[model samples]
Target: MRDKIESSLESAIFNSRWLLAPFYLLLILGILALFVKMLKEVAGLFHILMTGEGNLIIAILGMVDVTLVANLLLIVVFSGYENFISKLDVAHNSVDKPSWMGKVSYADLKLKLIGSIVAISAIDLLKAFVNIQSTDQTQLAWQIGIHLTFVVSGVLFAVMDRIAFGGKH
Candidate 1:
């Protein structure tokens, strides 16, 4: 009876990974929301083109930032699901399956996530610089500081991952 109870407890614990499924599903919804935002940004770009008043580079940067964030969410959804929840068995035979889908270990996911953040931060900083005429000097300083922090954090994450994985990734 004790052995049976223990077995049942372990089974329940293992099945709890499914609880994360709802979170991943929510991420998909977040991606859809981002799509709407990207469309709005595109419309803004068109307005700028028609009026020739807004800075094209800044508008372009806004779109790029949105795209990067969307990509980050997608990476998290796919890799996090595979790493924590279950295999995306439906994509196993799909020709459009991402190359990194099944292979991104948790460590790899961490690295990729940080890398994406750093890239997004850099783009935002670039936008600030491109609009330097109106950008607040103090805010620009903070942006630079924040971007550098991200860059340094990403480097440290990579180094530690290398040490932990013996340079295998």
Candidate 2:
């Protein structure tokens, strides 16, 4: 009787794993949508620049910002899902996985999030600079402060991660 009960419980748990699969699929789909959005933003930047109505540097910087953000999202969504929630089953027989994938623990993910936030914030600040005619100085200053906060937090996380991981070589 006890054996039968244990088997039933094991089956329940195994079946429940499928529930997480849909969520992971949704995350992958969301990343694809973000990629499309990034392309749209880049195309818009080119359009604005070609029309000679915008500051070229600001437009370019905006594109850079979007690209960085897109990359950050890709790393987080893909790595986090694969590491924490899903079994990616990346081929053992293929080329070895990248070092970053091996090194990116949950702690590292948090630190990278902070760093990405800071970078994105600075990009926004640069965009604001391009719109000096309409942008409030107070708003720009506030963004700068927020960006610095992210930067400092990221640095602290890196230090903590290093100490905890014994400096991950």
Candidate 3:
């Protein structure tokens, strides 16, 4: 009777992981919202270009930033689902499937996440520099500090992951 109870408890705990499924679905909703935001940004960029008023390069940078974030979300959604929930049973020869979908381990996911954040931060810093004349000195300093923090954190994460995984990932 004790063994049966223990087995039932273990099963319940393991099945609790399904609770995260809804959270991943919410990430998909966020991705959809980001797509809408990207479309709006594109429309604004075209308007700025047509008016020949605002800085076009900065506008382009904004679009790039949004795109990077969306890509990050996609990576997280795909990798998190596969790693934490269950393996996605895609056709081996399906061209539409991403090459790295099933291959990203949890460590790989962390690395990818940090790398994407660094890229996004760099883009934001570049945008700040492009608009330096209007940007406050304190704000710029804070941005630089935050970006450097992200860079350092990413490097540390990679180094630790390499040590832990023997660089296999």
* Best prediction by lDDT: 1
lDDT of 2 by residue, 79-169 (tens): 6765666645584345765557645768767877787888888889888977888898898889888878888888888888888889862
lDDT of 2: 0.76
Give the candidates in order of lDDT, highest first.
Answer: 1, 3, 2
Instruction: Give the lDDT of residue 28 in candidate 3.
Output: 90
Q: How good is model 2 by TM-score?
A: 0.75
* Each prediction's number of clashing residue pairs: 0, 0, 0
Best by TM-score: 1
Q: Write the per-residue lDDT of candidate 3 for residues 42-155, one digit (tens) a residue.
A: 998999978998989998998999999999999998899889888888646789888898999999999999999999999999999999999999999999999999999999
Candidate 3, lDDT over the whole model:
0.92
TM-scores of all models? 0.97, 0.75, 0.96
